[model samples]
Target: MFVLNTFDIGECLSFLCFISVSLIFCFFMLFASSVLGGKSLSRYKHTPFESGIDPVGDTSLHFSIKFYLVAMFFVIFDVESLYLYVWSVSIIETAWKGFIEAFIFILFLLLSLFYLIRIKALNWVHK
Candidate 1:
């Protein structure tokens, strides 16, 4: 003989609640921005320079390719690690499927990384 309580016995700080709250916040921000900002779109709305000031520059700035490569690599690996964190959380419930899925995902990620290395995408030393 068991009696169920009115309060939730299973809800333990749901991550879905956080997601929903953040979405609501985003919607409010969008609505507020649109309402308060007003519709002031005109021809000169986004002109970078003012007063016809001639842009004084050599216009020949070349960025180091290494800088961009590092940034992109960081982003790729960072996203992969983020997914890893999420996968870890549900690994217990999902069991074998979760293990196989995460394993294959990591395997593919490593393959891509290996491919990048083989292509020398990270090699930035200028000869």
Candidate 2:
């Protein structure tokens, strides 16, 4: 049913040429860097560098559970905001049904937030 025209063929060939050229350039750069870059490794080069700060006593540190809980709550709310944006964009098409659903979603989020607060999930000093 469909046929490729001369212009389409030209465009496809141009795309292929561009892709091939890009791949060749990337390969050449990688090869050149591996052969020429980073000569003579030293002990100082291998050491961990933190903003020119010397290596500290301990690298491992314990994080508070409240920090993780707050992070998770932030992520959950951020993702819900994305969904709300999508729903808002399609609000006209979805009409009344979309409005009610979005309202219910917001209500649930609020309830969950209240529950978390009531359970002291966000409290840092209490723990």
Candidate 3:
């Protein structure tokens, strides 16, 4: 039961046109590359090359648990920062209630960080 107005229809048409043009450009570039790019069947072409030197040993490296823990912490904090940014931007609309909610959110983040520190979860080396 939703109806779109003339302005909405115009916007939809423009969006469709933009998508069509983008797809056409992408396909054209792909086709041109396949046609114009060099085709090599040389033995060294498939080998992994790094810093102008031939790659030796396994390319895959095993990472420590600390690396993953730090990465997870970074991602968690990054997402929390995004939420805080949005809340800060819409402060006027949110007013006092939003301020309280954001305060609580920040408090929880600090508590969690402290908990991680107490548990030695953020420590780089195992004892």
TM-score top scorer? 3
What order do you get sorting by TM-score, best first?
Answer: 3, 2, 1
lDDT of 1: 0.85
Instruction: For residues 10-119, write the lDDT of model 2, one tens digit per residue.
Output: 87899999999999999999999999997877879788999998997988899978788889999999999999999999999989999999999999999999999898
- Runs of candidate 2 exceeding 4 Å displacement: 1-36, 51-53
Q: Deviation in angstroms for 52 in model 3? A: 3.4
Weakest lDDT window of 10 consecutive positions for candidate 1: 1-10
Per-residue lDDT over 11-118 for candidate 1, one digit per residue giving the tens place of the 0 to 100 score: 645766878999999999999998898677788667557478755767579998788889989998998988999989988887999999999999999999999989
TM-score of 3: 0.77
Better-scoring candidate (TM-score), 1 or 2: 2
The global C-alpha lDDT for each of the candidates, from Candidate 1 onward, is: 0.85, 0.91, 0.93
Q: How many pairs of residues collide in each model?
A: 0, 0, 0
Pairs with backbone N, CA or C atoms under 3 Å apart (clashes), candidate 1: none
For model 3, residues 1-127, the per-residue Cα lDDT tens digits are 3565536678789999999999999999999999999998998988877889877788899989898999999999899999999999999989999999999999999999999999999988777
Q: Please state the error at residue 58 of candidate 3 in Å.
A: 3.4
Error of 3 at 41 (Å): 0.7
Better of 1 and 2 by lDDT: 2
> Which runs of model 3 end up more than 4 angstroms from their true locations?
1-7
| Arranged by lDDT, best first | 3, 2, 1
- Pairs in steric clash, model 2: none
